[model samples]
Target chain A: MELAIGIILGCCALGAGICMGIGAIGPGIGEGNAVSKACEAIGRQPESKSAVTSTMIMGCAISETTGIYSLVVAILLIFVAPGLMVNILKEAINLL
Target chain B: MNRNKRLFKLVDILYISMIILPIMIAMVIKILTTPLSQGISISGARIFFSIPFPVQDLIITEAQLNSAFVLISILGVCLFLTHGINSGNLTTRHHIAEWIVEKVQGLVDGNMGEFFKGYAPFVTAILGLSGFSSLLSLCGLFPPTSDINIVAGWAILVFILITYYKLKGGFLNYLKGFTEPIFVMAPLNVLGEIATPVSMAFRHYGNVLSGMVIAVLISSALQGLSSMVLSWLPGFLGEIPFLQIGIPAVLSVYFDVFSGCMQAYIFAMLTMLNISGAFPQEEYEMRKKKKLLKIKNK
Candidate 1:
């Protein structure tokens, strides 16, 4: 049972790492593309740089959400929830 | 937790005092200091609250309390339900569903169409939190939002709402969200999907609470600096002691207005995406990309 919990946790770690790795990829590319475009627009119209930069940041921020989610879950797995699960399982096993 | 329980009780009392003390202080200060400051009154502003700061005493501006109200109301709705706080007139947590169900009290409350399907939780949360804050304010409590916990509570609420929405698809859909095109990576995707909200909540909560802390510190520092410098002002620049207001004022704008609003918006956006991400196209892309990568590696 200790091994089982160990394996479960190991899997959780691997799962969390993968979520962050893959989740980050598309958003990273999406934001890079957004910034590049915004720069082009700004270069074309220097006076409109404020507007362009604002939109670019907004778009990039939106694009960044998935990465943020991946992070949140990873932290939760590492720090918070597993403790609760472990406690619950222990109580259940003792009851049994 | 024992310490936390005591701290929370202390805060609860302070929350009650916050609603009363500032107005009382301003009134007393006014009655006593009037005729001297030429009738200058803090009570001129209809709404005032304090975000207890490192400084001697930092009273949040009218705009700050209004912003705090908007923010805390959204967050308080969640704590009202989950944190075992006694909210409303309820004596106990037995009516857990009652708090959630009042969400549907919409359309009936002259707020027609305020009850929608997907946005239901978000709207209900906002309304409930705001209503709770309003109740506290009406009862002359400082609304607890001026306290950082209220802001953190809002962040947690968003996180929970997102997680709950996403989970409706069952763990299978959640699992598939990360790597479902093939059997190998399906498990990885599952883990990634789950971690999203935890990050979003912390980032947002940190941003908003820290931003409030910054604004208070800046204003207080500036207040102290201006008064001290005025006495030392070269007689030539005597007219310009308060001219340095722009420095702290600008910092106040960026920290309190821009960053604060952006953090709140990010919290909401992530909340919307949590459940919405369950749609299958994202998985299909992940799977397709995974297969393509495998072939290229081969």
Candidate 2:
């Protein structure tokens, strides 16, 4: 029982760490690419700066939603799931 | 002139007292409640009270209270700004109100076209509520935006609006839209439609919650570090978490102010875009033509 609880807690922490670490990379790269392109577009058409900037921000924010989803999952795993899994495991052990 | 100056000085004193009194009262309460030996602990919003109901008890939380306060303050500001109006003589408050209205109108017009100008007030309300809710964290209160339920409610409202606009085309057409290209894609389309509100709610909630979590973590870390570093000093002075002073302010500026404002703007922009995009172009054109015909006939 002790071992099971320990494993559950340890795995949850690892999973949360991996979740955020891996999940952030895509959004980081995507946002960087977006901002760079926006800069290039602004350079090309100096007159449409406001329009390009707003569009860029909107697009970046939308793309960042995926990262936010991962963050939410990671937080859930870290804060909520371990205790829940441990409780379930304990109940199963008791039933057995 | 002397009498007028004295009255102005008295007003200044009153204004200063109004600001300081709250802080003084709060400090007194804190000192009375909290023991000196205990370090500051970060936690979720406290449940103030709960009401018993038939099915389940309704619990009122700090988020609800703070949000209510924010709403009331916003209402008060709006009332103050629009208290008196005149065509010839305008106050600075009038200018500020007009500027806010113009900006919201411009944003709606730019994003959703001139036809959707009527949604400016709706967009402004969302922007104000979300932005102010998040900014409430700066006052050391639990921001309502950090609560998933609050953001989810807003997202659901936007989702309903989106569906309503889409249904304006036709119920059959709205269903048919789900099977575009191939019937096999219908499930995916349905899932995508459902994901819209989920994503919006999660995105806003996660961002604000993460900021809050980080702020709390950093503050507690600073408290520990400060005590360790200042251990060599004398009694009360050593206990003081000096490192917690200026650093959190800088973090709060970015996390509370910038992130809060950006998320609010993005949420408002997405609301406008989704609602506008959901409206079928053909239907819009037909309505436009009908309106034009009516005007011409009149």
Poorly placed runs, candidate 1 (over 4 Å): A1-36, A42-55, A60-96, B1-191, B216-246, B279-298
lDDT, each prediction: 0.55, 0.85
Pairs of residues clashing in candidate 2? none
What is candidate 1's lDDT per residue for A16-76, written digit by digit as tens?
7787788789889999999999989888999999868756776777677666566657656
Off by over 4 Å in 2: B1-42, B284-298
Evaluate fnat for each of the predicted models and list the values in order: 0.06, 0.88
Clashes of each: 10, 0
- Highest DockQ: give the candidate number: 2
Q: lDDT by residue for model 2 over A1-96, one digit each (tens)?
A: 788899999999999999999999999999999999999999999999999998998899889988998898898898889979988998898999
Deviation of model 1 at A96, angstroms: 42
Residue pairs with backbone overlap in model 1: A19-B192, A69-B196, A72-B198, A72-B199, A73-B195, B19-B142, B73-B129, B73-B130, B75-B154, B178-B189
